[model samples]
Every structure is written in C-alpha cells, then in structure tokens.
Target: MQEPIRQSYEAAKELYAQHGIDVDQVLRELEKLKISVHCWQGDDVRGFLFQDQALTGGISVTGNYPGAARTPNELRSDLEKAFSLIPGKHKVNLHAIYADTEEKPELDELEPRHFQRWVDWARERGLGLDFNPTCFSHEMSKDGLTLSHPDPAVRRFWIDHCKASRRIGAYFGEQLGQTCVTNVWVPDGYKDTPADRMAPRKRLKASLDEVFAEKLDPSHHLDAVESKLFGLGSEAYTVGSHEFYMGYAIQNHKMICLDAGHFHPTEVISNKLSSLALYTSGILLHVSRPMRWDSDHVVVMDDELLDIGRELVRSRLLDTTHIGLDFFDASINRVAAWVIGTRNTIKALLRAMLEPVEALKKAELDGDFTTRLALTEEFKSYPFGAVWDYYCDKSGVPVRENWLAEVKTYEQNVLLKRGSRASIVN
Candidate 1:
C-alpha cells in the first residue's frame, strides 16, 4: 500500500472506532457483498443471438461507441477487464439472447448447453451467474407484446423460452453452487390506451403460471418477476405494473425485481424495499440512473443510490436482496461504464455499512430525531474516502479515479483495435 493511503486508513479507522463502528468489520462485510454486473452493458444489450435485430421493447442504446463487443469472447474479455478494475468477486448477469452455441437454436429451443461457455467462464473465475429471459428485440415481438400476446402461438413461444431460461439458470446454480436468480422482465404492453387492460394482465398472469409450472430446486434456482411503469413505446399501459407483480410475487412466492428506472420519476426503490420485504420472499434490484424517463444512464453516487444502500443495510435486508446493475450507455467506454457504476454501487453500500446503525436506530426508537439527523449529516463528511481507498488498495484495484487511466490504456491497446470487429448500430 502507498504510505499516504496507509496513514490515511489508520486515521480513518481510529475516527470510525470513536463512533463504535468497526472499520475492519465493515470492510469484511463489503468484501463478501457481490454486485451482479450485467453483460448487456458491454455490448449495448445486443446479445449474440440475433444479428439484424434492432433493439425493440423500448430499449435503445444511444451513441455509436466504438469497440462494442461483437462476439461472446470479446464481451467476456471486456467483462474481465471491468471486473479486474472493480473490487471483490461478483456474479455475471446474462440474458437468454447471449447464448454461445454453434447451433442456431430458436429461443424456445435454447438449452443449457447453449450457454455452457458462460458457465465455464464464470466457474473459472469463481463467480456466480444470474439470468434473464430476453422477451424483446425479436421477430415474434414486433408488435411490442410478448407472453401476454392474444395469439396463443406467440404466447406459447415466449412461455417456452422463459421455461428454457429457468432451466439454464438452474444449471448455472447447480454447477456453481450458488443460487441463480432467473428474472423475467417482458415488454408486454400497449403504446395506446388499451380498450381492455384486465384481459392482457390476466393473460400475462396465466402465461407466467405456465412458464413457472415446473418447479426447480429452490436451493439452486430462484424465480423473479420484474415490473415496469412505462417504456418508450409502451407509455400508455404496462401489463406488469408494480401492484400487479407485487401481488403476483406474494401469491406465487417469487422474487420481484425492482428496476430503478422502471417506475414513476418520483418513486424510488429505496422506499419500496422495507414495505415489500414484509410480504415478498426476496428482491432483485436493477440499480440504474433514470434521467426523467427510462433512459438508462450509468449509475452515480447520488442521494438515491446512497439511500438504497442505506435501506438494505439499515433494514437488515442484505441477505434476501439480490443487487444487479441495469444501464447501458453506448456513448461512453462500455468497460469503464461497468467499472464506474459497479464501484459506485459498492461505495454506496460501504458507506451504509460504515454507519453507526444501531445507535441511529436507538435514537429513532427513543424519539431523538435531532441526534439521528445530526449523526447522519455528520457522517457524510467523515473519512469514508480513506477507508474506501484502503479497501480498493487491498482488493488490488486502483483507488478513486485512478482506474480511469487503466481503462484509457485498455481503450488505446485493446478496445480500439476491435473497432473494425465491433457491430456499431447507426
């Protein structure tokens, strides 16, 4: 460690000790916390399954950033670089469209063998894997409805795809010895006000029931359903609204995914955690930065992000919560986007873990709001940076913005060379 960093950590450790916060324990807990990084960010959600498919389902990657990964190996290589720059081991979240098979299998025909390379890659790094069934950006979803489409043939295709995805998720868990969260987030909604919304929702619920009919081992595979308020085209009505999924998750005993960008601009997932934790079995958080709409900008260390971490730590919901990042900015260096967002997420959680939660809770319980407020504000200026730097140093990652230099070097040497190979959209 650098001498200055070592000295700063020593001083910060002593300062946190005065507030009854064990810095060592905080770091240890942080070390164990894993943030699942989404593979879509590396290639702007353009998975390897389809070559000519434009991003449908209200999903669009802005900017024609050079060197976006075109193949499975390139994406994995980029992910490796991003993982190296971030602290701690984490899981890799994959979509069904990211299958790495030589055979051109239909979505419904997809099997675990198609994603064997991903499992092998994850196993080699001792990282867990999470999965999603890609229900958008396909020929079947041209009308912007999936799973809830009125046509049974269309609905059956998506249902089978989701079932196949769950099996792949179970295979990941069984092979890696970690529970794989197979989350379902479909873009089944209408652009205009529907004459009948209830029918679509009912169809969706029934479709989901059939999709999850074959129960997988809970120890290996866990199911989660995601909800959205609105999307680019589906601004009028979204079938899987929060209320709908919240009720469904409670009834079906499944995890409900809360994407930060998938709600009203005024609503924050941090506030929903405590209330939902009371009824839901588990939560899958897709942390993102939404600028007014569902424009998935890269996550930053903003107030909402900090509060999300605070809620998880404060409410003791860390164990039941599965945190995954969901943002794709093709405008920036894709690998750097991953590093920046994942590191900030860790920082947010670390900041919360470093808090004197017990004392704060006691003050709240005793009606000492002033003390609680004062301490909360005061800790913001505390030596959190020192401890964070130390943690990064110990984890063998660059501290602060220093990681940017490595990303720049990678761009010059590795990323730029792949520009010709990258599939740039517009």
Candidate 2:
C-alpha cells in the first residue's frame, strides 16, 4: 500500500539529490505551509494510560490492557500538582470516574447521587461524553456477558447498563443541544477453534433487538458495531452488510461510524468508508487518519484521502467533522510530541489542500483518479504557492535569494533565546 508512494517519493528525492537541492530549506518550507488537522483531542499522555507514541519514547502494548482511569477532579488539578504548565484541554468521553464509579454503596451498591454529576461536568466544558454500555469479556461485565452472552441474568445486567448509559447520554443531549452516541463494538467473535454461533447468534440478535426496542430514545445514542476480522477461518457475520446489515439495512435512524483504520490493513483504494457510510444514510463519523503500517498511529488524512478521496466524495457518505485524533502517544513527552506530530501531519495535509480543486474537475473528465501529470514540487508543497512565490502572487511580496540566510540570522540572534521543549509542547 505505501510502497508505490514511497517509491515515487524516493525517486523524487534522488532527482533532487542529483541536482544538489537543499533538503533542509525544502523541509522548512513544507512545514511552514501546513495547517493543524483538528487541534483537539489533546493527542498526548495524561488522557490515556499510554504514552503518546508519536513523541520521543512510548510504552509498549500488552494484551487485555487495563486502567481504571480516574478523574476525581478532571485529572486537571492533580496534573497541575505534577507539572508546571497545564496540559492541553481536559476532555472526557465517558470513562469519568466521578460520574459512573463514584461510590454510594446503596441500591445496586451505589446511589443515584454518585452517578448524577457527569452530565453537568461534561456540559460545562463542552466535551461530547461517550461510552459503550455492553461490556466485553472482562471483569467489567457480569460474568463477562456481552449483548450476546446467554445467561438471562447476565443479559439483564447488560440491559441495565445500556439503559443507564442511554439516560446519561440523553440527559446531556437534551440539556446541551447535543446527542450521546453509544459506540457498540460487540467483542463476541470466537477464538482459534471450530466456530458455531447458531445459538449465540440468536442471543446476539435478541440482545441488539432489545437495545433498539427498549433502550433507545432521543437523547440516548447508538452507533454501528466496530468492524473487525474474525478468528481462524470464519468470516465475521455479526453485521456483515450483505447478510445482516443490522445497523444499515434497517431504516431505523441509527448510523454507521467507520473507524478509518478498521477496514483492510493492506491499503486498497475503495470509496472512503465514511462516504459509503454516508450513502447508507449514516453520518457522525469517527475520524482517525489511516496508516498502512498501523491503525492507531492515525496521522494524515491526505495520505488516506489521496488513496480514496475521489470515491469517498463520490460515495458522499458524510461530511467530516474535526478529524478525530484517535491516536495514543506511547512515547515520552506525550503532550508536546502529539502537538508536533499533529503539526507535521497537518502540514502534509495542508500541502494537499494547496492542491487546486480544479484537478478533481479535470479528473472527472479523465475517468481515472491517477492519470499521471508533471507536478512541480512547489505546486505540490505550496498548495498556496512556492513559499516566496505565494507571497509574491497574493500579497505582492518579494523574496531575495538571500532570504533564507537572512531569516536564519535573525532567528538565531533573537528567536533562539526562547527556551525549552516546554514551549514547543505546551
């Protein structure tokens, strides 16, 4: 998937090297011309247990990773006690400890008072609070029962959780002019063995049926199941569009939210899943950029967009909101690194944005998305224009050949006084 593009870039690199082109200057120009992708999601550490991987260093992943992520005071005050500067905005999407885990030790082992404040807390800061009620095969679930688990008692437990979750989501929506979306990813597939779900499938269907039948409301939310592969030789059929399209086939209002990286690992340009999702009358997409190497390191949409944008636009599945920074920084200095990586990624995307919309129009007549044409590096880099060229073109500005030399001199003489990684990250 990344091979062809990397190869093309390599060829260009060689051509420039042969011509003795100044790479550093070229890179700086590229960096200066970019835009931030979303600039939200804090894309760093302190948000998740893991380090922000895009930065210096990161923690490694292990199976069944766990954390009881506490937010006794929004993790803000506690964080202030640890660091000199504030991290990015403290955002929450449902794992708020004070909200759900607050102890009451009363009915169902907790009182309603314990669960009541998340609505206001989330509203005050304007974070879209979200969570999945159907627990996976972990200690969190009653006997590890997902929606599909058979024991009626366990099923009842699952139902109760969804009911409560829906209410919480809805309360916020009703009060805040928003909607709480429940992202349901049924982790009910089999392990590496002969698989049969004749009985379990029935239970699974019943579980979702109960969800739509009894657990939904105007404020409550439900998105489609998370798309994933099946184990061993079996194909995942839980919501296979052809066979079950449980979320899409039916016309009930629930929509499909495609994780950018959830589709095929080997990048094949199909219509953008979001576009396809929109065609299925779904919107409210989850926006993490895709990577041919890993799903989680969501960095650039242009990389993904170039591969699938035209079809995605053609599919017209939905419009994009702020592209979600669905990545985890598994590295040191998780915060600043997230910002830097985002800056780099956005720069790359802005480079693409610099591309004229006219290209798409020409491509429409051409019938092929990838008909090759000679594109100058400046055109590719400065969707706006060549760094100096743009200033000249739009603002009637001019640059001398010694411009780089002059800028470097001033930056060192003055700007270099600015100190520390803290300035960069914070």
Candidate 3:
C-alpha cells in the first residue's frame, strides 16, 4: 500500500515482463503455497507431558532462551503472533507430546479428546493441522530405541502409541476437512557397531506393519515415514536409515519424508525429489538447516533452500509434495525465528515461481546448453525482492525487514513478562 513499494513493484513488473515472466501470476501462485510451521520451535521440543524431564532421544535444544511456552494456550498465542507476521495461509505441525491436557495420559491411552483444543484453535484460524508421533523424550525412548527395540513389550508399547497417534491424526483431518499427514520417526539405533543390523530393521518393518494394520480413509489421514542417517547418540548405526525407509516406503506404498538435515553432510534432498516422486505417491519435506550435523537450526534463504523450491516448481511436484518447516533455534527470539523461516521459505518459492522455466527447458531440449546456462545465470539478478515485497504488502505482513521491529517490541512487553512471572513463583 506504500507509494514507494507500489512504484518499485511496477518497475520490477516491467523488468520481469522483458523476460516473459508475469509477476502477477507468480504472486498469485505464491499465495496458494502453504508451509506448515513446526510447534516444537516455539518451545524447543520441551512438551508439557513432563515438566521436569530433560530432552531425550538423541535430541537437545542449546539456548536457555526465555519465554518458552509452558502451556497449550501460551504456545497457541505465540504461534498466532508468528503467523500474523508471515504472509499466506499456513498450517501448524504438532507432535503427540504437545497434547493439551492436565493429566499425563499414557501414550497408548492418548485419544482425540487430548487434541480437541488444538482442533478448535486451528479451526478458528482456518488453518490445517499435521501431526507426528512423539517417539522421543520419554522413558520408552531412554535407550534410543522404541519400535525396533528387541523387547516385545517395549516394541508393542510404541506400536500402540503410533496407532493411537494415527487415530488422532484422522480426527484432525476429519474435523478440519483436510488430509492430515501423520509422520513416523523413531530414534531406534545403536550407539556403536551392532552385531546384527538386519535384525533391527526387520523388527522395525514388522512393527510398522502392525501399527499400520488398520487403514484409515486416505481423505482423512496420510502416513509418512522419516529416516535419519545418524544422530547424536546413534552415530555408528541408525536402524531406520535412508535406504531402509526408501525401500520400505516404496514397497508399502507410503509417503517418505525427506528431511534436509537427515542425510550426509554433502547430500541434498532437492536432487532426490524427482527420482523419488516417480515411485512414491507423494513426499513430506522437513525443511531445515544442518550445521555439520542434524542441528535443526533456523532456516534462511540459502542456496540449498532455493534449489529445493526450484526443484519442486520445475518438476511440477508442488501438488504432490507436502512442505513443512522443521527447525528449533532457542538462541534467538522464537517468534522472530518462526517469522523469518516461514517468510524466507515463501520468498524462495516465489523466486522459483518467477523463473522462466519454459524458456530454460526449451534451450535444454534444443541442445543449447550455453543458452540454458546463460538464462539461468541471468535470472539470479532479477528483481525478485521487489516482487516479494509486493506480495508481503498484499498479504498485510511487514515488508522487507520491517517485521523485526514488531518481534522486538513483543519480546520486551510479552516474553520478558514470563521471565518475571517465573522469578516471582520461585
């Protein structure tokens, strides 16, 4: 609505027009894209299930940042604040551990009522909800094993937990009238070398089969399995390795989640999308940044992220790919982290949408590698920022870096007050 922004957007529109790219069309498409924001980031994976317990299952949040949400209401409020600053309609991804209840219900006993509050909250905002079974940070996962544990009792407990979670996911989807993707990710592995790797994987496959024995309607719920190369404790052998999950997903006709930080340091998920899409029904992307490990750092508009957005658009897999953010940075303002990551993700997708894909593909098909490379390089300097700002303006979100001011004000007035309350209670 600002005069300068409108003028800049007009100039950028003209520039893109020269390249046969419609900035308006790109903006329209970008508006339709939705990225599910992870709830764990707001609380650093510290769910309300056990207030005194430390983070378990080879996961840890580094910073002792203040204003971490301690209750369902607080977390939802914080999420609303973050969503207000980011453009576009988005969804919220919840872990089973985040059940809004006063009594500590056993994993196997968890039902749809535990999440009724979440459903009500999301419905009020016209937002969809995704879910994950909390396979970590509990006594069941103390040994870094759950579904693949050698003990039948331990494995059965986790299976029941997963099954219960699926039912909850179905409830979410049925109430919201949108399919909820309930992903399974267990920290089942060995700290050192294992005498028998195949045995654990076999056990895992059997466990999954039992958990997914009863199929829910696809319209209400979708199942996805996540794999990690290694983790803090399971460095030597991760039972649910990428190869294992890929094979299992393909054989069972399930969605495979490809996390950006769940692979070798040099490997990227963007290149894997095309190949995997050919076999799988769809993909669930856990977009995150890795600092030499699965650190789950806040995302930025980096090259890898841009490549991911480009691949999703270029391959025409946007409809098949379920995009969601997966990161938890306790070092900075949590609301700002959400706003920055979600906005940057939208920005990357918008930039990819603005590309002249038809021209580049034509050059490639005509065997004009030189022309293709030239066109690709030239797009790097396009006025994508202006279009992004225009889109933000239209969405009623802060344009450029203006959102940072709102976050700082919120930290001073709202977040700091929580610290004061804790001190008073102590």
Candidate 4:
C-alpha cells in the first residue's frame, strides 16, 4: 500500500507540474490550515452541566446511537480518538455548558477556573481552544428568547452570561498563547408572526452593546456574533437575522459568524465570504451541512464545501477566517462522525490549495472567458485523491477507509462495553 501511494503521488506531482502547480507546497500549506472541531458531537450536544434537561434553543439532535460521552473525561477521550485519525493539529471548540464542575452554577457566575482542566488538556496536546456561551437549554431560555426577551430581568441574565463568557475566553487565550474566538448565538424569535419586529431587534442591539461593553485585548481573544434565518420554534422571525448581525459587525468592528446551515436552502456561504471580508475585520464560519433547513448534519466533501475552500484560498482570506465545525449526529458512532467530517473538510482545503489559482486569475484578467471556463472544468479532474492519500500516510494516519476499521474496533472494545453496562443497569 505504501509503495502504490508513493508511485501515485509521484505521478500526481508530475501532472500538477504541467500547470505550474506545486503539489508539495500545497500539502505544506494544508498542514498549516486547522479546523476547530466542535466538542458537542461527542455527546450529542448533551453537556455535563445540565444532564437532566431536554435540549432546547430551537435546535434538536436526532437519533440515539450508544456510546455518547457522559462526562468530561469520556468526552476528552473520545476527542483524542477522533483527532488521532485526523491529520492536522486542530483546535477544540467548547460551550460554557461543558464546564467540569460539581456545582450547578448559573451561567452568569461561570469563571475560568471551571475550565482549567480543559485548558490543561489542550496545552498537553498542543491544541488551540475556541469557546461559545450556552444560551439555550435552560429555564431562562424556554420561551425561545434570550437577549431579545421583553422582560428586563431575563435579558440581563443572558447579558451577564455572555459577558462572563468573554472573560473566560480571554483566559483560554492568555493561558494557551493562542487567540480564542468566543461566538455568541441566541435563539430569540417568535414561533408565529409577531405584530412588531423592530422591538426585538432594538432590544437585541442594546443587549449586545451591554455584553460587549468591556473591552478585551484583541491579541488574547476575539468576539463574534452568529445569526440564523429561522429555527425549530422561531420559524416566523429570527431576531438575529443575517442583516442584523452584518450591520452590527460592521459598525462594531467585530467578527460575524456565517453558519452554513443558518441560511436559506438555496443559499450557500461560499459566495458570501468575499463580500463580508470587505467590511468586517474577520469572519467565523460554522461549517455544517444543512438538509433543506438548519439541520446541522455532518459535513461531506461536496460541491458547496469545495466552493467554500476555493473562495477562501483564491481570495487569500484564510488569515481572517476562523474555520470551525458545527454538527451533531448520534445515529452512528459519534467519534466516527468527528473523524469523517474533519477529514472531509481537510480534503476540501487540500483540493483548493492544489488549484492553479494564479493561472485561472490571469485568464480572467485577460478577458479570456473561454480559456478560464475550460481551465476551471479541467482542474476538477486533477488527481486530488492521490495527494490526499499521500498526506494521510505522511501524517501517520491510515491512508483511506482503513481508518474505519480502527473505529469499528474501538467501538467493539470501548463503546460497546459502555452500552452493555448501561443496558444492564437500566
């Protein structure tokens, strides 16, 4: 297998050289690109903070495959397993609800000490950390509103939570020596058509102002606001619509999060990157696969994913873009979901890096429409798989579907044993 992969990669290197493309340089650049893997996938979005409550905030995780991580130790162990299969040293995105604490502290009272274990874990593995404030799944958010809640008391609660979250995020960066991205997303909207929409938007704006009143050093932490078109219960109106956050991000000079699953079914985030980059200081991408609505399915190496990679690479916007996965699937092995999604995202980036971007841009600039289109179509057939296989081998991971067998073996030895014990106890 090693000999065949080496031969294939050598042939691919020569083929790319014909078009003035450097496969070796592309692989090297890919090694530098990191995707922040979400921790929610390991536990089906069930954080340890509130184990008894049902998932809320207009989002739901479907299917119940056994072996969901029940504690912080288990979740971290699962993440380690998933990362070993993936090729790059990536970051871990965490939610406030995942804190390893014995007391059920209110969201506003959360402190950095609660997450010291996670920081130590990341430091030990040389991984970066990203964070999110959990604004859902609590009694305060049962009304499908948070920052935009009409009651001043309820709104203030969420505001305090977000404020504390920023401090915690900055702590992660200060300790790890990597800037942490703390994204704020609220599920505030109406289930049915509301008589007035401006009120909610107004309230949301003021709430955000209060939450961000404290300034944190940009070197340590960055703040981002995420928007959604609609959600499970808030179908009629979503307070944090794309337009609302875009305008806020521009005025506030903050990073705006573009969630792939939060847009209309026909809309893809690939075409929006260049436009947003012109106005915002940076962008945070919540890379997820949307099935008609904001389903948050596991990502695949599909057209839209490839387009996102191409646009990021061609426009040279990678430096300003923070890539993170956002999906939860419990029907299969949760660890496998993380491995598959992260690997596919990496594959898309590798393909984008291998493109003859300079040549294509010259054709466009020269007004050679026919040549540009021809080259665009021709490059699609490039031996991207060979390069991908070689990358896996070099990274010390299995070279293809071979990784699947390892996951199955892990399930039989680890996951299955857990499931069996749970069944017996029940």
User: Candidates 2 and 3: which is better by lDDT?
Assistant: 3
lDDT by residue (52-103, candidate 4, tens digit) is: 7788888889987888887888889899999999998999999999998777
* Candidate 3 RMSD computed on C-alpha atoms after optimal superposition onto the true structure: 1.5
Q: Model 2, stretches more than 4 Å misplaced?
A: 1-92, 95-101, 104-118, 140-145, 214-222, 230-251, 267-270, 287-295, 298-302, 305-325, 336-354, 366-379, 383-426
> By descending TM-score, how would the candidates be arranged?
1, 3, 4, 2
Residue 97, model 4: lDDT of: 94
All models: lDDT?
0.93, 0.40, 0.91, 0.92
Clashes of each: 0, 16, 0, 0
Q: Which of 1 and 2 is ahead in lDDT?
A: 1
Poorest lDDT segment (10 consecutive residues) of candidate 1: 417-426
On a 0 to 1 TM-score scale, where does candidate 1 land against the true structure?
A: 0.98
Give stretches of model 4 more than 4 Å off. 419-426
Question: Better model by TM-score, 1 or 4?
Answer: 1
Q: What lDDT would candidate 1 get against the real structure?
A: 0.93
Candidate 3's C-alpha runs over 4 A off are 420-426
Clashes of 2: 16
**Tens-digit lDDT string for candidate 1 (1-426):** 999999999999999999899999899988998899999999888888886688899888889788899889989999999999999999999999999988999999999999999999999999999999999989998578998999999999999999999999999999999899999999888889999989999999999999999989999999999999988789999999999999999999999999999998999999999999999889999999999898889999999999999999999999999999999998999999999999999999999998999999999999999999999999999989999999999999999999999999999998888754333422
